[model samples]
Target chain A: MTTIGENATIYREQHRVTYYECDQTGRATLATLINIAVLASEDQSDALGLTTAHVQSYGVGWVVTQYAIDVTRMPRQDETVTIAVRGSAYNPYFAFREFWIQDEQGEQLAYITSIWVLMSQEKRKIVKIIPALVTPYHSEAVKRIPRLPRPIHFEADTQTISKPYRVRFFDIDPNRHVNNAHYFDWLLDTLPAAFLLQHDLQHVDVRYENEVQYGHTVTAQVNQLPVAEDGTVTTSHVIQVGEEKCCEVTIRWQPTTQPQA
Target chain B: MTTIGENATIYREQHRVTYYECDQTGRATLATLINIAVLASEDQSDALGLTTAHVQSYGVGWVVTQYAIDVTRMPRQDETVTIAVRGSAYNPYFAFREFWIQDEQGEQLAYITSIWVLMSQEKRKIVKIIPALVTPYHSEAVKRIPRLPRPIHFEADTQTISKPYRVRFFDIDPNRHVNNAHYFDWLLDTLPAAFLLQHDLQHVDVRYENEVQYGHTVTAQVNQLPVAEDGTVTTSHVIQVGEEKCCEVTIRWQPTTQPQA
Candidate 1:
């Protein structure tokens, strides 16, 4: 079993934001931020001698089930940022991870918590977590990381806003599935452009239920929730391929400041 | 006026393919390859002290108008590839560049020829090429390079197949417009999956006409031509945003190997 100690490793990686990673506003996309975090986690796993090759050798792979992210500010293109990640803890079937993005000045920009599970490639099902799998990695459980609640179920019959998208070849990642991060783009794009332009994303909680493959046409539908007194608007999104639910996401947005003349 | 010289610099840069840059087939996407080429060109410009900031200081930016790419093979993820770029020649308003992608062993993977025009950001019009902008880059004009012919104008009423796509937030680049490369994905994805899977992209010729912005719903229409005796199929794509024609692309694909038993 992995023992908690001061010698546990916290992986750190620095990346310069590329033009392709930025959005129209020159800020790093949410998907890019998550990818940066994943890179840090992958580096940590590599350091522990648990690389993708090692996991595939055992006929299993790690899959993130849920993520909760909070952003104070989004990094801009050409900005160099650092990501620090650590395996917080693990239950029998679930492992928790925490990720932080900071600038060169050491100012925190974003914080994220994610839940992951092991899956058997042959069986296409969740596998029991073996003690050996998590023991080698540093385990320093975080006491107050934000918990991403289970995605709220949404009924399509009640949804008033629906957008259709076809999965392009570039959407597929090395894992042979539509990247989980792309779902954030699909969800946020479903909102009205006027609303999106006037607001900025504040927080997000998402859960992946099924994998989307290439050439699939997915429809994303959003159900608007009540607005808060603080001028925050919330929405629940359901992405579906035919009758299968691919994923669910909930997002919160706050009004953005108008540019001064 | 800039004079041709033997002392000009041919800019080169190396990049390792990331997971996000690969497609489901584990090969780097065509758009990703082109992005690598652009990075090399940008590096060359930056070295010449003609960075974006320098160009914008004059109220102009370089925009690629046409590209012709020939791929011998696509790079795989984790493969470090070098992109060497040089300014081959320039007319009064158009500058030509040549790009080559090779492995550490110096084996060539792809070669590209592109035509760029300086555009006034304020007036949104083609501007005269400045001698100072093209003089420092090497001008070893390629003796023979594939020329991208002007796209045959297409009548919307004649197009038989049309695919709808929204300009997602991530599609926007640092220029605040839908990236020129994303148009490649939108065009290629319009083909039937069966045809795409059975064939491999061998060459591409594209021309960018209009800039797409956030919230634009564009339609990509494809016109398939007769197959050649060598089993090569060609298609022409026209992307339109409402009544405004956005871009035109012509792609040729060759038959690929059958699936392994």
Candidate 2:
């Protein structure tokens, strides 16, 4: 496979898709793809001296705030794939990172842009971006970092499909919080199985507003937008714990029927 | 680390645990531990000539029937560990395998014994084990293979806690059945969080009797026996889809508090 980068700006890691990581289609699921990115980023952290060991020593860590993912295709199980991540930019409040996946042939399959913030472990409060943390990674300091597209607003009175979702202990990560990827499971699974089987997910954009803890039961609410003339579809989702909105996601899809066969 | 084996009889794979594989305690969870063994066994299959490609070509695959796990310590996240698996024996209907996990310093952390059966992909029926499939691994055949200890039966009239668990899409493995490891989550999560937090799991023995498909809503039934004088506790669990018992598990736990500081 061609190298993702030949310089210090980009970090890349190769992963072989395992059976347990794939879905019924024999392809990696959205959560699995996001996990690959997370793994690669962790590798980069280790390489750049911001290893978990180093960061935890200071009683601080990074937490993801939002993510926007775009997909062209899904890799099948056992396919060796590469994930490349780059620190895009950072300000006093937020840092931006970009992640992309490539097939064994070095063809791009999917990409994700995520927003994160450094937080104090003890207080669980956001902290300023320390100059030392950013300097070691050698990331460019842009005047303005790009943000995910604004979610389209649906009619305020529209009814939504809702399902009860309970957070299980296994969903809790080492960070003592629910892993962000699991939000996708609650969001997507809320849709009808027939809808999922009849359409292919094309894009996803999500914003995490609150952290969900173990033993918390939340309601997953979904609303489908009007279908376009070309048969494309969009859906809006929200996960709420009582009256608190924990997260929000918007997804786009295309019909599964082959074109001009 | 010391070598696991120098011959084909034992298959070994080394892994550095990632952040998501760990729990709040920074240690691997029961499901993650089982997943590591499954991954190593898949590697062995690939190395010993029964790769997924080869197995799929014959329209048959191996399915676990039962597992008995003994744990002395749990590896923390980022720790490098090795999983070694050995094919013990096989008859016309069953195959026995053994798995063990070791730390980087070569200390044994956990061990597991599992039973498996080959099932045809189309008919979903058990198939005869061909000698060619087992000969490449060169395992020793024995007169008889011991089974996991039977779970202590709970009184039918006794009150038990039951939780509704709906199988999510991601829980389904590539084989179209619920992954064996996920049963641990459903079984353990049914317990009260306070009980889980106050105790450390000691041992687990489980038998897989029926397959749970995606979207199947099953009731997780848990029965806790009275704590013994020495602070040992045993719990019996059964996962039932309607009236059919899907699986059974018995777990032992010890209070986290020490007798004396």
- Model 2 residue B243 lDDT? 89
Worst ten-residue run, lDDT, model 1 chain B? B1-10
> What is residue B136's positional error in candidate 1, in angstroms?
4.6
lDDT of 1 by residue, A1-261 (tens): 223323446789888887888865667888889988987787788788998888888899999999988888888887999999878777667777788899999999998888888999999899977666777776644343335677678766554699888887668777766787888788777877567667767888889989887778899999878789989988889999998998888888787664211
Candidate 1 lDDT score at position B148: 62
TM-score of each candidate? Answer: 0.85, 0.88
> What fraction of native interface contacts does model 2 preserve?
0.69
Deviating ranges (above 4 Å) for candidate 1: A1-8, A46-49, A139-147, A151-160, A223-233, A242-244, A257-261, B1-7, B136-147, B150-161, B223-233, B242-245, B256-261
**Per-residue C-alpha lDDT of model 1 across residues B26-121, encoded as one tens digit per residue:** 678888998889878887888889888898888898999899888888887778899998887776778788888998789999988888889999
Most TM-score-accurate candidate: 2
True contacts kept of each: 0.77, 0.69
Task: Give the Å shift of residue A32 in candidate 1.
Answer: 0.8
Off by over 4 Å in 2: A1-8, A51-60, A120-127, A154-159, A226-231, A255-261, B1-8, B51-60, B120-127, B139-143, B156-159, B228-231, B255-261
Q: Write the per-residue lDDT of candidate 2 for residues A122-171, one digit (tens) a residue.
A: 99999988767766666656556676775554333446888888998778
- Give each model's whole-structure lDDT: 0.80, 0.80
